[model samples]
Target: MTILGSHFVDFDTARILVADDDPILREFAAVHLATPTLEVEVAEDGVFALERLQQGGIDIALIDLDMPRMDGFELIERIRWDDQLKHLPIVVVTGREDMVAVDKAFAMGATSFVVKPLNWRLLSHQLAYVLRNAQAESSVRSRLHDLQRVSDLKDRVLRLSRQKLTGPLNDILDSAQTIEHLSTIPEISASLRRIAEASVALTRVHADMGEAERLTPAP
Candidate 1:
């Protein structure tokens, strides 16, 4: 299906979990939400939903506020607390007048909310929007982490390059000094002097690199 401002969404590869105690609502969601590219899995209650989620492969979750065994509120809390499931996008599906439940769902980290008497025609589009936005957010976070890693590596390389050059530069300077001391000829002494000056300049460059490395913040 097409999402606004983007290419066609490949729902087929998406695995959606519908958690509700009502059989009719579960069937309705499965029929309306399913597509050629998408697979919808139904859970009779929050406990079953948690079990399936723990088994993994759930890309998104549609949770009902009222259910037997665990209920959606508690399930959302458990999911948020679990490291593996904490990042999963959750959409709370509830009654239109359930404002209290809605607020609690958001506070518990529900990605979004949907009101029922299910909008059969709009369900797919709405879900697509939520999934797209969640995916975009995840992509941005991943890119930021990659950029940080690259920046850190660059800083480390700069530090290592300076360290590797320091000893060799000191040895070059020492050799230049020895040559200048042993050679009494004016031309030879002048050449050694130039060599020593060049070595000192290179050493200063290395020192500048060290200072820059220190100033650069760690990622």
Candidate 2:
């Protein structure tokens, strides 16, 4: 395998899509971009490339600016507009001396780019970096989502504790203290009324304890 990283994706089966009008450069990319672990697929023009992308299962796309059916800029625009494919990595491969096209491609959401008459080594390095970095970023987003879910669950439990458990338990403790105080009263100590009050207080305490137990949250 040419590259294996801690990004949590199976890099060995990663598929690449290369789109260009020129068969020569398309072949060049198809040959040079493939590692032992990488697979490369080619599209003759922008439209075909987009069709393939929409079908899914591709990891990254290398697009050429000048093409017959939908040029690279439109391809990039369409991909960004699409919710499913918006985050797909797109590398612009163009020979045009016009810096405007390069700038526009970036504005249009091209992830990376290499000029035509590509330095093979530089192109290889750049593509590798893009793939690895994309995997890392995706991994980070997934972790953040998981953390947010845990935080939300914790907030919910805390609310339940305060609203359902704390208030009722505090009232139960207060009732117990009131019963103790009533028992110490000199005149009522041996009176029938004091015994009745003690009975009522104990009954209420039992009910409150049952309610509190019912509201106790499971782990």
Candidate lDDT scores, in order, read 0.88, 0.79
> Which runs of model 1 end up more than 4 angstroms from their true locations?
1-12, 185-188
TM-score of every prediction relative to native: 0.84, 0.68
- lDDT per residue as tens, model 1, 1-219: 576764334453688999999999899888777877778999999999999999999989999999999999999999999888998999999999999999999999999988988875566767777787877888998999999989888887997899799899999999999999999898999999999999999999999998898887666
lDDT of 2: 0.79
Per-residue error for 122 in candidate 2, Å, reads 3.0
Error (Å) of candidate 1 at residue 92 is 0.3
Assess the local accuracy of residue 24 in candidate 2 as a C-alpha lDDT between 0 and 100.
Answer: 92
Candidate 2 — worst ten consecutive residues by lDDT sum? Answer: 1-10
Top of the candidates by TM-score: 1
- List, residue by residue over 41-120, the lDDT tens digit for candidate 2: 99999899999999998888999999997999999999999988988889898775868889999999999888878876
lDDT score for residue 49 of model 1: 98
